[model samples]
Target: MKNYVAFTGLIGAVGCFLLGPSICHATENGGTVWPLGVQTVLPAILPALGETSLYSYTAYYKADSFKDNRGDSAIPGFKLENFVQAVRIVHTWDVTFDNGVTLSSGVIGSANKIKVDAFGSSDTDSGFQELYLTPLYVGYSPSENLHLQTGFGAFVPLGNYDGSKLANSPTGNASYTQEFDLTWFPHPNWEVSVAPTFTINAKNDNTDYRSGNVFNIDYLLGYRLQSNPKVQLGLVGYYTKQVTDDHFDHGDVEDGNRLRKFAIGPQVFYAFDQTSGVALKWMKETSVRNGPKGDSLWLEFAFPL
Candidate 1:
């Protein structure tokens, strides 16, 4: 009877959290989430995070096999693999109004490396990827257990880019993005979180080409070890889909190049304290289309200032 009651409570908690969040999805160019839930514990903890420190995180992603627009394996002639490493540093501050609204604001900057290799072909590329801003973000908490985060910013085209090359880092144009993250903790030891992003791509002046708009979602479901609350283990995943068609020549259809992909894996996170932690995650790509078909490995470290 006690077990049944606990299970019912778990289901209720999960349902409450999931209803407001999006699904998990893969991506960066394509998109992924490091997780706001992974960083906070109790509801009040949010204010502390914003007020006490700057957060620094470093993560690496390794993937192979580029999927074409149809989500099929890449065209018959080329092969692809990618190793991308990124570093992000963020600073945030919190405000709590008398009306009981808690607001947090922050900014993030990142540097990345994207390496690609192609087999059965002559295309091979590797080097400095790029540098960009993640988001100048603002977050709101309506209740102790629920937080909503949003980032309205652009990724600067400061990376290495070649208009003619398929493997370059920059899109050759600034891409605007609005990022949304919803975090919920129904129990002291468990959490459910999601991040969804909407992106608008600009025309590449160098190539006279414009890519499609993108939507990506990332998810995390976690539980802290009862014996060691700082150690968290769970499932992490993401999905990304292109909603618009790529057009060139001022909206003339060049190609309906849309993409879709899904990936999921086990993740572990351990925090030494409220100010420091490390995480490891591995995702296996599945049901992919118009994207890469392979696995990704992520190792992350978080530092709070």
Candidate 2:
């Protein structure tokens, strides 16, 4: 585990240098037009075993739309539409040593979609659509208070319209991400974490899609209601920047645009008991420059096997 962490750090640093500083500014200030959907919410429900046990697998789905204001159409139809579905199964084999240290590992999977309609057209020629399995990763928690994770994944497009479709589709680019997170509990009811993540694209189609290197900084703050262990609330926020030249798989587009996104939202979790629970979460993204933006809603139910 230690060796893997070190290797990830080295690869991230090298990717940053190779991409250069111009790539950092292209998309850094805009909202994520490509709805990655809710990656953080609805994770596997951790079992209360205090020992090794198979956690609960959860399923989730969300649909969202965004209107275009580009002013080209008398009435711009819904410019962006997205649908996402995912299933995650987690098993934690925990070992507690005499030093009070605990170790755990788990895996996750997902399927997501992003569709954009043409400005004023109703046919398939108007825009592009992509559907792909986006998550396949392993994570580890060194202690209840600290977590670290990394994974390799691929994204493939389901449909494309114009020559630019590949560049703009959500699943057009394939990449690997390395993420590390740390959480600390200062009190019985409050917990916080700082996570830094890096993404490297193995393929980029150029056009509107630029892939290279990106960095994300995430913050999570949660509080458990003093009166009920069954209820808890959390606030999550994150900022991400493209750290290298946005590389396009094709050859005609510019390579120096920056991309950045910021989001904050509330999450609620309800525990029915030791083996079951429900969750609700919501978030919105606003365009800072010339990027796609939208909002999302999610509901999930989980229970042990």
TM-score of 2: 0.62
- Model 2 residue 290 CA deviation in Å: 4.6
| Model 1 residue 177 CA deviation in Å | 0.9
Model 1 per-residue lDDT tens digits across residues 167-271: 553335566767677778889888887777777877656555556777767777889899999898988877767787765554444246465767788888788
> What TM-scores do the predictions have?
0.75, 0.62
Range of the 10 consecutive residues with the lowest summed lDDT in candidate 1:
1-10
lDDT at 34 for candidate 2? 26
- In angstroms, give how far residue 112 of model 2 lies from its true place: 4.4
User: Best candidate per TM-score, number?
Assistant: 1
Which stretches of model 1 miss by more than 4 angstroms?
A: 1-64, 100-109, 117-119, 123-131, 134-136, 250-255
Error of 1 at 286 (Å): 1.4
lDDT of 1: 0.49
